[model samples]
Target: MTPGTPGNHGPGPGDSSTMTTVESPRARVLPWLSTLARLVLGGVWIAAGVAKITDLDASVRAVRAYALLPEAVVQIVGPGLPPAEILLGALLVLGVGVRVGAVISTVLMAAFVVGIASAWIRGLSIDCGCFGSGGALAPGAEPTYGRELARDGGLLVLALFLVRWPAGRWALDAVLTRKDPT
Candidate 1:
Protein backbone atom coordinates (compact mmCIF):
# COMPACT_ATOMS: atom_id res chain seq x y z
CA MET A 1 0.00 0.00 0.00
CA THR A 2 1.12 3.54 -0.70
CA PRO A 3 -0.12 7.11 -0.41
CA GLY A 4 -0.57 7.33 -4.20
CA THR A 5 -2.32 3.99 -4.42
CA PRO A 6 -5.98 3.92 -5.46
CA GLY A 7 -8.67 3.02 -2.90
CA ASN A 8 -6.34 3.80 0.02
CA HIS A 9 -7.85 5.09 3.25
CA GLY A 10 -4.99 6.79 5.15
CA PRO A 11 -3.19 3.42 5.07
CA GLY A 12 -4.04 0.24 3.17
CA PRO A 13 -2.78 -3.26 2.55
CA GLY A 14 -2.24 -4.97 -0.86
CA ASP A 15 -2.99 -1.77 -2.79
CA SER A 16 -0.80 -1.64 -5.92
CA SER A 17 -2.71 0.61 -8.34
CA THR A 18 -2.57 4.40 -8.79
CA MET A 19 -4.30 7.00 -10.97
CA THR A 20 -3.24 10.42 -12.23
CA THR A 21 -4.96 13.07 -14.35
CA VAL A 22 -2.23 15.66 -14.78
CA GLU A 23 -2.17 17.16 -18.29
CA SER A 24 0.64 18.98 -20.06
CA PRO A 25 0.16 22.40 -21.62
CA ARG A 26 0.02 20.88 -25.09
CA ALA A 27 -2.62 18.44 -23.98
CA ARG A 28 -4.74 21.22 -22.57
CA VAL A 29 -4.39 23.34 -25.71
CA LEU A 30 -4.97 20.58 -28.29
CA PRO A 31 -8.66 20.12 -27.52
CA TRP A 32 -9.43 23.76 -28.07
CA LEU A 33 -7.49 23.83 -31.31
CA SER A 34 -9.36 20.77 -32.40
CA THR A 35 -12.60 22.52 -31.61
CA LEU A 36 -11.65 25.34 -33.95
CA ALA A 37 -10.77 22.90 -36.67
CA ARG A 38 -14.09 21.10 -36.28
CA LEU A 39 -16.11 24.30 -36.50
CA VAL A 40 -14.28 25.66 -39.52
CA LEU A 41 -14.35 22.38 -41.42
CA GLY A 42 -17.95 21.77 -40.52
CA GLY A 43 -18.98 25.23 -41.58
CA VAL A 44 -17.26 24.85 -44.92
CA TRP A 45 -18.96 21.54 -45.54
CA ILE A 46 -22.38 22.87 -44.66
CA ALA A 47 -21.97 25.94 -46.82
CA ALA A 48 -20.72 23.92 -49.74
CA GLY A 49 -23.57 21.44 -49.38
CA VAL A 50 -26.24 24.09 -49.13
CA ALA A 51 -24.93 25.92 -52.13
CA LYS A 52 -24.98 22.86 -54.36
CA ILE A 53 -28.22 21.44 -53.00
CA THR A 54 -30.11 24.53 -54.04
CA ASP A 55 -29.16 24.11 -57.67
CA LEU A 56 -28.75 20.39 -58.24
CA ASP A 57 -28.98 20.77 -61.97
CA ALA A 58 -26.15 23.26 -61.85
CA SER A 59 -24.24 20.91 -59.59
CA VAL A 60 -24.63 18.14 -62.13
CA ARG A 61 -23.40 20.44 -64.84
CA ALA A 62 -20.43 21.31 -62.75
CA VAL A 63 -19.54 17.68 -62.31
CA ARG A 64 -19.97 17.02 -65.98
CA ALA A 65 -17.63 19.87 -66.82
CA TYR A 66 -14.84 18.07 -65.02
CA ALA A 67 -15.03 15.26 -67.55
CA LEU A 68 -13.53 13.02 -64.95
CA LEU A 69 -16.31 10.50 -64.58
CA PRO A 70 -18.85 8.72 -66.69
CA GLU A 71 -22.31 10.21 -67.07
CA ALA A 72 -23.81 7.49 -64.85
CA VAL A 73 -21.46 8.22 -61.94
CA VAL A 74 -21.84 11.96 -62.44
CA GLN A 75 -25.61 11.64 -62.25
CA ILE A 76 -25.41 9.85 -58.92
CA VAL A 77 -22.53 11.83 -57.40
CA GLY A 78 -23.79 15.25 -58.40
CA PRO A 79 -27.10 14.78 -56.62
CA GLY A 80 -25.80 12.72 -53.72
CA LEU A 81 -22.83 14.89 -52.76
CA PRO A 82 -24.82 17.77 -51.28
CA PRO A 83 -26.69 15.66 -48.76
CA ALA A 84 -23.60 13.73 -47.80
CA GLU A 85 -21.67 16.94 -47.29
CA ILE A 86 -24.44 18.34 -45.15
CA LEU A 87 -24.54 15.20 -43.02
CA LEU A 88 -20.81 15.15 -42.57
CA GLY A 89 -20.88 18.82 -41.66
CA ALA A 90 -23.63 18.21 -39.13
CA LEU A 91 -21.71 15.42 -37.44
CA LEU A 92 -18.52 17.46 -37.23
CA VAL A 93 -20.28 20.56 -35.98
CA LEU A 94 -22.16 18.50 -33.38
CA GLY A 95 -18.99 16.74 -32.28
CA VAL A 96 -20.51 13.34 -32.91
CA GLY A 97 -18.00 10.78 -34.19
CA VAL A 98 -15.63 13.58 -35.08
CA ARG A 99 -12.85 11.28 -36.19
CA VAL A 100 -15.13 9.59 -38.67
CA GLY A 101 -16.42 12.90 -39.90
CA ALA A 102 -12.93 14.31 -40.28
CA VAL A 103 -11.80 11.26 -42.18
CA ILE A 104 -14.68 11.61 -44.59
CA SER A 105 -13.88 15.27 -44.95
CA THR A 106 -10.26 14.48 -45.71
CA VAL A 107 -11.20 12.06 -48.46
CA LEU A 108 -13.58 14.50 -50.07
CA MET A 109 -11.03 17.29 -50.00
CA ALA A 110 -8.44 15.10 -51.61
CA ALA A 111 -10.85 14.14 -54.35
CA PHE A 112 -11.66 17.79 -54.94
CA VAL A 113 -8.01 18.74 -55.10
CA VAL A 114 -7.43 16.09 -57.68
CA GLY A 115 -10.44 17.08 -59.68
CA ILE A 116 -9.47 20.70 -59.72
CA ALA A 117 -5.90 19.97 -60.67
CA SER A 118 -7.03 17.66 -63.42
CA ALA A 119 -9.30 20.31 -64.87
CA TRP A 120 -6.57 22.87 -64.76
CA ILE A 121 -4.07 20.56 -66.37
CA ARG A 122 -6.55 19.67 -69.07
CA GLY A 123 -6.98 23.37 -69.85
CA LEU A 124 -10.62 23.55 -68.89
CA SER A 125 -11.99 26.96 -67.94
CA ILE A 126 -14.39 25.83 -65.26
CA ASP A 127 -15.59 27.27 -62.02
CA CYS A 128 -14.70 24.85 -59.23
CA GLY A 129 -18.34 24.99 -58.08
CA CYS A 130 -17.00 24.14 -54.65
CA PHE A 131 -19.36 26.43 -52.83
CA GLY A 132 -22.06 26.49 -55.55
CA SER A 133 -22.60 25.96 -59.24
CA GLY A 134 -19.51 24.35 -60.79
CA GLY A 135 -19.36 24.95 -64.49
CA ALA A 136 -17.38 26.73 -67.15
CA LEU A 137 -15.96 30.15 -66.47
CA ALA A 138 -17.24 33.18 -68.38
CA PRO A 139 -15.78 33.89 -71.80
CA GLY A 140 -12.17 35.06 -71.45
CA ALA A 141 -12.40 34.80 -67.66
CA GLU A 142 -9.40 33.16 -66.05
CA PRO A 143 -9.85 30.19 -63.76
CA THR A 144 -8.55 30.61 -60.24
CA TYR A 145 -7.20 27.13 -59.85
CA GLY A 146 -4.37 28.23 -57.64
CA ARG A 147 -6.58 29.86 -55.05
CA GLU A 148 -9.10 27.05 -55.15
CA LEU A 149 -6.46 24.40 -54.60
CA ALA A 150 -4.98 26.37 -51.75
CA ARG A 151 -8.35 26.66 -50.06
CA ASP A 152 -9.12 22.95 -50.33
CA GLY A 153 -5.57 22.19 -49.25
CA GLY A 154 -6.08 24.22 -46.13
CA LEU A 155 -9.35 22.42 -45.42
CA LEU A 156 -7.62 19.09 -45.88
CA VAL A 157 -5.13 20.10 -43.23
CA LEU A 158 -7.93 20.92 -40.84
CA ALA A 159 -9.50 17.51 -41.41
CA LEU A 160 -6.20 15.80 -40.69
CA PHE A 161 -5.86 17.75 -37.47
CA LEU A 162 -9.34 16.68 -36.33
CA VAL A 163 -8.55 13.09 -37.17
CA ARG A 164 -5.49 13.25 -34.96
CA TRP A 165 -7.28 14.99 -32.12
CA PRO A 166 -11.01 14.30 -32.06
CA ALA A 167 -11.65 15.46 -28.52
CA GLY A 168 -12.51 19.12 -28.15
CA ARG A 169 -14.35 21.58 -25.96
CA TRP A 170 -18.06 22.32 -26.61
CA ALA A 171 -18.48 19.03 -28.37
CA LEU A 172 -20.79 16.10 -27.71
CA ASP A 173 -17.77 13.83 -27.64
CA ALA A 174 -16.35 15.63 -24.64
CA VAL A 175 -19.65 15.68 -22.82
CA LEU A 176 -20.25 11.99 -23.46
CA THR A 177 -16.69 11.01 -22.57
CA ARG A 178 -16.97 12.90 -19.33
CA LYS A 179 -19.92 10.71 -18.40
CA ASP A 180 -18.03 7.50 -19.14
CA PRO A 181 -15.46 6.43 -16.55
CA THR A 182 -13.35 4.68 -19.15
Candidate 2:
Protein backbone atom coordinates (compact mmCIF):
# COMPACT_ATOMS: atom_id res chain seq x y z
CA MET A 1 0.00 0.00 0.00
CA THR A 2 1.25 3.43 -0.90
CA PRO A 3 1.98 5.91 1.97
CA GLY A 4 -0.69 8.40 0.80
CA THR A 5 -3.20 5.83 -0.44
CA PRO A 6 -6.60 5.66 1.28
CA GLY A 7 -7.01 2.54 3.54
CA ASN A 8 -3.24 1.98 3.26
CA HIS A 9 -1.17 1.50 6.40
CA GLY A 10 0.78 4.79 6.32
CA PRO A 11 4.59 4.59 6.36
CA GLY A 12 4.83 7.23 9.12
CA PRO A 13 1.83 6.92 11.45
CA GLY A 14 -1.79 7.38 10.22
CA ASP A 15 -2.38 9.90 7.44
CA SER A 16 -3.33 13.23 9.03
CA SER A 17 -5.53 14.19 6.06
CA THR A 18 -7.94 11.27 6.64
CA MET A 19 -7.81 11.22 10.44
CA THR A 20 -10.82 12.41 12.42
CA THR A 21 -10.28 14.24 15.67
CA VAL A 22 -12.03 12.73 18.69
CA GLU A 23 -12.97 14.72 21.77
CA SER A 24 -11.40 13.53 24.99
CA PRO A 25 -13.53 12.52 27.97
CA ARG A 26 -12.19 15.51 29.86
CA ALA A 27 -13.19 17.77 27.02
CA ARG A 28 -16.67 16.33 27.01
CA VAL A 29 -16.96 16.85 30.75
CA LEU A 30 -15.70 20.42 30.86
CA PRO A 31 -18.98 22.12 29.93
CA TRP A 32 -20.83 20.69 32.89
CA LEU A 33 -17.98 21.62 35.18
CA SER A 34 -18.08 25.11 33.72
CA THR A 35 -21.80 25.33 34.37
CA LEU A 36 -21.38 24.39 38.01
CA ALA A 37 -18.56 26.82 38.45
CA ARG A 38 -20.56 29.60 36.85
CA LEU A 39 -23.65 29.06 39.02
CA VAL A 40 -21.69 28.76 42.27
CA LEU A 41 -19.62 31.83 41.62
CA GLY A 42 -22.69 33.74 40.55
CA GLY A 43 -24.63 32.76 43.63
CA VAL A 44 -21.79 33.87 45.83
CA TRP A 45 -21.63 37.24 44.17
CA ILE A 46 -25.38 37.68 44.42
CA ALA A 47 -25.39 36.81 48.09
CA ALA A 48 -22.52 39.13 48.86
CA GLY A 49 -24.01 41.96 46.87
CA VAL A 50 -27.46 41.56 48.38
CA ALA A 51 -25.98 41.58 51.84
CA LYS A 52 -24.31 44.92 51.21
CA ILE A 53 -26.79 46.70 48.96
CA THR A 54 -29.19 47.31 51.80
CA ASP A 55 -26.71 49.47 53.63
CA LEU A 56 -24.44 51.47 51.38
CA ASP A 57 -23.04 53.25 54.37
CA ALA A 58 -21.80 49.98 55.84
CA SER A 59 -20.22 49.12 52.54
CA VAL A 60 -18.53 52.50 52.52
CA ARG A 61 -17.27 51.94 56.04
CA ALA A 62 -15.93 48.55 55.02
CA VAL A 63 -13.91 50.15 52.26
CA ARG A 64 -12.83 52.90 54.58
CA ALA A 65 -11.52 50.37 57.08
CA TYR A 66 -9.10 49.04 54.48
CA ALA A 67 -7.57 52.52 54.17
CA LEU A 68 -6.04 51.37 50.92
CA LEU A 69 -7.62 54.09 48.78
CA PRO A 70 -8.15 57.81 48.98
CA GLU A 71 -11.43 58.95 50.53
CA ALA A 72 -12.81 59.94 47.15
CA VAL A 73 -11.97 56.57 45.66
CA VAL A 74 -13.35 54.81 48.69
CA GLN A 75 -16.60 56.71 48.44
CA ILE A 76 -17.11 55.62 44.87
CA VAL A 77 -15.84 52.06 45.24
CA GLY A 78 -17.73 51.26 48.40
CA PRO A 79 -21.12 52.03 46.92
CA GLY A 80 -20.19 50.89 43.45
CA LEU A 81 -19.01 47.40 44.33
CA PRO A 82 -22.35 45.90 45.38
CA PRO A 83 -24.16 46.75 42.17
CA ALA A 84 -21.25 45.50 40.13
CA GLU A 85 -21.23 42.24 42.01
CA ILE A 86 -24.95 41.78 41.54
CA LEU A 87 -24.73 42.49 37.83
CA LEU A 88 -21.80 40.14 37.31
CA GLY A 89 -23.49 37.45 39.35
CA ALA A 90 -26.71 37.74 37.40
CA LEU A 91 -24.82 37.50 34.14
CA LEU A 92 -23.09 34.32 35.26
CA VAL A 93 -26.28 32.84 36.64
CA LEU A 94 -28.10 33.49 33.40
CA GLY A 95 -25.15 32.19 31.36
CA VAL A 96 -24.94 35.44 29.44
CA GLY A 97 -21.51 36.72 28.51
CA VAL A 98 -20.10 34.08 30.83
CA ARG A 99 -16.47 34.58 29.90
CA VAL A 100 -16.71 38.30 30.52
CA GLY A 101 -18.52 37.71 33.79
CA ALA A 102 -15.89 35.25 34.92
CA VAL A 103 -13.13 37.68 34.08
CA ILE A 104 -14.83 40.39 36.10
CA SER A 105 -15.42 37.99 38.96
CA THR A 106 -11.79 36.94 38.95
CA VAL A 107 -10.72 40.56 39.14
CA LEU A 108 -13.07 41.29 42.02
CA MET A 109 -11.96 38.23 43.96
CA ALA A 110 -8.30 39.07 43.39
CA ALA A 111 -8.89 42.56 44.68
CA PHE A 112 -10.61 41.22 47.80
CA VAL A 113 -7.80 38.77 48.40
CA VAL A 114 -5.24 41.55 48.12
CA GLY A 115 -7.21 43.81 50.41
CA ILE A 116 -7.61 41.12 53.04
CA ALA A 117 -3.96 40.12 52.87
CA SER A 118 -2.85 43.68 53.16
CA ALA A 119 -5.05 44.28 56.18
CA TRP A 120 -3.67 41.17 57.83
CA ILE A 121 -0.08 42.11 57.13
CA ARG A 122 -0.63 45.60 58.48
CA GLY A 123 -2.11 44.12 61.69
CA LEU A 124 -5.35 45.92 61.11
CA SER A 125 -8.12 43.89 62.71
CA ILE A 126 -11.18 44.25 60.48
CA ASP A 127 -14.04 42.37 59.02
CA CYS A 128 -13.45 41.52 55.35
CA GLY A 129 -16.74 43.23 54.50
CA CYS A 130 -17.18 40.59 51.84
CA PHE A 131 -20.80 39.98 52.82
CA GLY A 132 -21.29 43.45 54.17
CA SER A 133 -20.89 44.57 57.83
CA GLY A 134 -17.26 45.48 57.37
CA GLY A 135 -15.28 47.85 59.57
CA ALA A 136 -12.64 47.71 62.27
CA LEU A 137 -12.95 44.64 64.43
CA ALA A 138 -13.72 45.00 68.09
CA PRO A 139 -10.82 44.88 70.51
CA GLY A 140 -9.91 41.26 71.39
CA ALA A 141 -11.70 40.05 68.23
CA GLU A 142 -9.42 38.09 65.97
CA PRO A 143 -9.25 38.64 62.21
CA THR A 144 -10.16 35.71 59.96
CA TYR A 145 -7.93 36.57 57.06
CA GLY A 146 -6.95 32.95 56.43
CA ARG A 147 -10.51 31.75 55.98
CA GLU A 148 -11.49 34.75 53.89
CA LEU A 149 -8.48 34.34 51.65
CA ALA A 150 -9.12 30.64 51.20
CA ARG A 151 -12.76 31.20 50.25
CA ASP A 152 -11.91 33.93 47.78
CA GLY A 153 -9.12 31.79 46.35
CA GLY A 154 -11.55 28.98 45.71
CA LEU A 155 -13.98 31.32 43.98
CA LEU A 156 -11.14 32.70 41.89
CA VAL A 157 -10.38 29.19 40.66
CA LEU A 158 -14.02 28.73 39.69
CA ALA A 159 -13.99 32.04 37.85
CA LEU A 160 -10.87 30.98 35.96
CA PHE A 161 -12.51 27.72 34.92
CA LEU A 162 -15.59 29.52 33.65
CA VAL A 163 -13.42 31.95 31.74
CA ARG A 164 -11.60 29.11 30.02
CA TRP A 165 -14.71 27.03 29.25
CA PRO A 166 -17.66 29.35 28.99
CA ALA A 167 -19.77 27.14 26.78
CA GLY A 168 -22.10 25.51 29.25
CA ARG A 169 -25.49 23.83 28.86
CA TRP A 170 -28.38 26.34 28.92
CA ALA A 171 -25.99 29.20 28.32
CA LEU A 172 -27.36 32.13 26.40
CA ASP A 173 -23.89 32.66 24.96
CA ALA A 174 -24.07 29.25 23.35
CA VAL A 175 -27.47 29.98 21.84
CA LEU A 176 -26.65 33.50 20.75
CA THR A 177 -23.29 32.51 19.35
CA ARG A 178 -24.89 29.52 17.56
CA LYS A 179 -22.35 27.16 19.11
CA ASP A 180 -23.17 23.52 18.71
CA PRO A 181 -22.69 21.67 21.98
CA THR A 182 -22.07 18.40 20.24
Index of the highest-lDDT prediction = 1
lDDT of model 1, residue 132? 76
Candidate 2 lDDT tens digits, 68-160: 999999999999999999999899988888888988888988998999999999988799988987675656778899999999999999998
Which numbered prediction scores highest in TM-score against the true structure?
Answer: 1
Global lDDT of model 2:
0.80
Off by over 4 Å in 2: 1-21, 136-140, 179-182
Lowest lDDT 10-residue stretch of candidate 2: 9-18
TM-score of 1: 0.84
Instruction: Give candidate 1's root-mean-square deviation (CA, Å).
Output: 8.4
| Model 1 whole-model lDDT (C-alpha atoms) | 0.81
Error of 1 at 85 (Å): 0.9
Each prediction's Cα lDDT score? 0.81, 0.80
RMSD (CA, Å), each prediction: 8.4, 10.1
How many clashes show up per model?
Answer: 1, 0
